[model samples]
Target: MNPVKTIQRLWLLFLLQIPFALMAQHPVRLAVAGITHGHSDWIYNRKLRGDIEIAGIYETNADRVQEFRKRYQLPENLFYTNLEQLLDKVKPEGVMAFGPVNEHIAVVRACAPRKINVMVEKPLATTYKDAQEIADLAKRYGIKVLTDFETSWYASNQYVRNSYKEGRLGQLRKVMINDGHEGPWAMNRHFVSWLTDPVKNGGGALMDFGCYGANLMTWLMEGQRPLSVTAVTHQNRPDRYPKVEDEATIILQYPEAQCVIQASWSWSFSRKDMEVYGTKGYAIAADPVKIRTRMQGASSEVSQTLEPRSAPFNDPFAVFANVIRGTLKLEPDDVYELPVNVTVVEILDAARTSAKSGKTIYLKPRPALVQAGNVGNN
Candidate 1:
């Protein structure tokens, strides 16, 4: 071939190889701590993306491992019965817990000493004690511990949050958050077993879906602990959820705002929507991507559809990847931050207590509670 033709051929080859090179570059190496949680499907079911790669998975149940492997066609070598061994083998950059809520502490305990960050599904822990321990461990090890919520990735929620922060919503007044569906009893046995267990899941809808509202409210309050928590719970389906309540309603009172959280497994249909009312206007996150709003003096409410969020905000794994790679920095009370989730766990804990006692529970002042892992760093 002529020299000019040879050079042209080389340039064409380089262009052809660019996409392959980019596809294989800088994918976040992540480990799954457990695969029993119902939400564990999030990892396996997500559309393939170049930004995240599952390095290893640890599940104590051999049957579950086999089932998942067959279902997802995952490699045999990628499965491990021991978490620590899985971590040592793959050396993942972070661990995402797909275990029972109480088991989050174990995941963090193992990863923290290794200086590996962790992200757990919502509520952080089954109890406040575990949440505090996880927080302390992360602080001591200088690793990031995040709690992931599906709502955190919602464009509508982000839009509402931005509107509030930018003063479009004006001073906060009340927020109403509705969450949950018609129970998890119909889910797989592995998921249903732990999810309805009092110890494994903390509580029923109060701990399962209640955390969403608590997490959002804490973030909206900028990590402020609620002044008081009042709650009522009902066990509507004794045949299905024999051990836990199927319905919960919680009231969070702030100095100048109040939030009503309706979390139920008895809803006629699934929903995860919230309404934020301020002095000047109100915004309703109708769903993940739709927002209904009414501004001060506006005659009619307006509904707007939002585009998908940009990278690092569009999905939980994206956020985790960006944070681990130092491309994203979490604000003090960003919905996913540890402190906000800690407060969320606190609120859930209080809600459980109030429901049990049929009395409102008063909380300590913000400063006093901060010492005990109540707030995130500003």
Candidate 2:
């Protein structure tokens, strides 16, 4: 080849690489809706890291809008009075709905038709019908809908899931989990407003904190949908949480194992721990971020803890950004499929039904498990 021709071909190859490199570095633009939820702060801080831009913020309540603006030092132009105006102006690639549970459906409905990816705070919607509607809308539009079950993305949970896949826990038989904090009334004065309002919050502490237990249990058990769920609720602090139950104990039964999930807004003590018992070994963890395990024949327990590497928040905004950038695929949909946001809503609804009926409520039969070898095909 001629010397000049050889240099020209090399230049062409370098130019081709530039487009791919630039595309890899592009940021995802995200607009956040409803700044009243506590988790919104995490999203705000994480999005500031340069991978994502907080294009806009919307809140229905004027007071909340003012509070957020002052807290975050957001400019007036970036604040909108409602979701429709915000979406129209910003045209974000994704939206984080951090609104109240009752407002979730409306926000999702508004965004899904635009084919915007959305990450709704857990317990997708306040009611079963609304939850199903959101899921249906997203499916129709081919929008990726996810819940902010942040713990599911924790490194410790990933380690535990990997262990379960390796059969280290061996034929799981039972799980015991607790997720509680001081009652909402004591934790925040505003918590009692909509959270205790059955019309707005849907159920009670079960819908709020109980969903975490249900989601975590489902994730750890290889996505085994519960066959039946039975629950009991208590209103011990009726004066404080006037319209909502203060505590709840739930049992989720599967073909292979039974899970006990306890949630409360009345506990004076704070506890967040999980114990997994199986035919061969047992695993325990304070949160999904830390876990220890023991196998039947092992001489001693093996322990692992994931050091917090990022900010104090549990926001997975970077993960979402990577998904958009095509740098990382969504978590495998096998034993530990990334949860579809609506499924969390459905599980919470079932638990509430079981509690209300004073009897076990059976779920629709789950599809056959995607066996280990065939998991990736989906």
Report the number of the highest-TM-score candidate: 1
Question: For each candidate, what TM-score against the reference?
Answer: 0.90, 0.89
Considering only N, C-alpha and C atoms within 3 Å, which residue pairs clash in candidate 2? 183-265
- Where does model 2 exceed 4 Å of error? 186-192, 299-302, 307-314, 332-340, 366-378
Per-residue alpha-carbon lDDT of candidate 1 for residues 219-305, written as tens digits (9 for 90 to 100): 888878889999999999989999999999999999899999999999889999999999999999999999999999899999999
Q: Model 2 over residues 1-378: C-alpha lDDT tens digits?
A: 899999999999999999988876677899988776767778656435567888998876777777778887888888887788889889998898877788888887888878777777777787767866765676567666566665655666566556677898888798887878887664433445677888778878898888877777777765557888899998987788777787999898888899899988877787777788888898887665777889899999888787753532244677666554556555544212333344456677887888888988888864333222222212
Worst 10 residues of 1 by lDDT: 369-378
Clashing pairs in 1: none
How much is the lDDT of residue 256 in candidate 1?
A: 93
Q: Per-residue error at 17 for model 1, in Å? A: 17
C-alpha RMSD for every candidate: 4.7, 3.6
Q: Rate the local accuracy (lDDT) of all candidates.
A: 0.88, 0.73
